[model samples]
Target: MLSTNPFALSDTRAPLYFSDKVALVTGGASGIGMATAELLAREGARVVIADRCRDDGEELAARLRHEYGQALFVETDVGCASSVQALVGRTLLEYGRIDCAINNAGLSETPVDLIDASGEQWERLMAVNLRGVWLSMQHQIRAMLDAGRGAIVNVSSRTGLVGKPRLAIYTASKHGVLGLTRSAAIDYAPHGIRINAVCPGLIHTPFVEQKFGDGLPELARTMNPLGRIGRPEEVAECIAWLCSDAASFVVGVSLPVDGGAVA
Candidate 1:
């Protein structure tokens, strides 16, 4: 069991839980993904940041290597099978093994009635949010299976647990993520691999700020029991714990890091 409460952190100082391990974080250029990468690196893990944003990804990887430890940035479009495969291959080429993976690359569509949603938009969202996770897991699980041990945390959303008006496609995609987590967990548990999902509430990420603007805080207050928005670091802490030995007994759980929003 984890001795310290993950939610009570006041700073970034964490135990070296992932020392010498290699962690792969998709969508690691910004927001929740970036925070998770930073946390893992700080805890002594060599990190590979895979994302489509070349500049941001490269910058983050450089910062991590200079300030923390070994880090690499691989330009990846998770929706593309080739890109995801190269990402895994590159990680192995550089680091030799993958011990942890955070499938955090996802996108959200503008809120619109189901009837008003376009087939193109829905397909686009599914490609990255749903298929992306599945593809990443396929390769990640293969590597972990070879090593006989590993952990995975897929980033879902609060919307995955409940229906939200005007977010039909996004909700469906996230729900799919949870389903994948559970089924994969069952299949891989005996193989020494753990798979789980983190359903985050209205986290205050750059993407959220751009989407919600000045009303973001108020909207978060109205939506969650905590009456405020969550920080990226807050969500990152949950992801880190789920990937660590502290959560060895935990598997296939969709943890809600949402400030009681779902409750």
Candidate 2:
């Protein structure tokens, strides 16, 4: 039902569909997470940015609060059960409820062939990308159940639905994210909680730079049918819509925000 271009952030006066909502975004210090946090705050949601990057987290929170006055940053390692618990507890204590959550804290390993991928590296990627989402969803769903309404957007990737060479661990972890999103949606939809995922193509963000470096620009331009990589804000828009009332009927779906890359 969201007819407006979900990839464009040009509509400045667009409605604050999330006004009064208390939203939380993990891995909110940079890339799509940060862009999503900024957009949510601009839409009048009180946002809690949870990330392990202390300085960037604080700086982003400060910038949002100074500009919008409804942003808070909490240092969190989503992979840790204790840290995740404290994150949910603190958010409730500070804001009284959690209306939405975006679990985006994830890392990619250096490219390695399937046979070359080490057990430790695979486990490490799983710990953060898969287990982290599981923990965050467990707590967020608990909070939302008490309040009787909520939405969750897991930051998945195009690689989740398609295999890519030399990225064994990362692809496996992302595929797990898709599985989690579907299962959680089925379990919580009756409870008024919606769970979905955004599988983005290459996007211009710090994370992409870390993963692909100078080659990313060229990669993005020619990677898909659209002939370009995506921007962080473009991915953020899809996430924002999935979190909004406009996407009320959308649930348990892995919507691809790719530039026709998976097609």
Candidate that would win on lDDT: 1
Candidates' C-alpha lDDT:
0.94, 0.91
Q: How many backbone clashes does every candidate have?
A: 0, 1
Query: What CA RMSD would candidate 2 show?
Result: 2.6
* CA deviation > 4 Å runs, candidate 2: 1-15
The sequence of per-residue lDDT tens digits that candidate 1 reaches over residues 6-64 is 43424555536788999999999999999999999888899999999999999999999
Strongest candidate by TM-score: 1
Each candidate structure's TM-score, on Cα atoms with residue i matched to residue i, is 0.95, 0.94
In angstroms, the error of model 2 at 25 is: 0.1
Cand. 2 Cα-lDDT? 0.91
lDDT (10s digit) by residue, model 2, range 187-245:
99999999999998888887677878878777877899988888888888889999998
Clashes of 1: 0
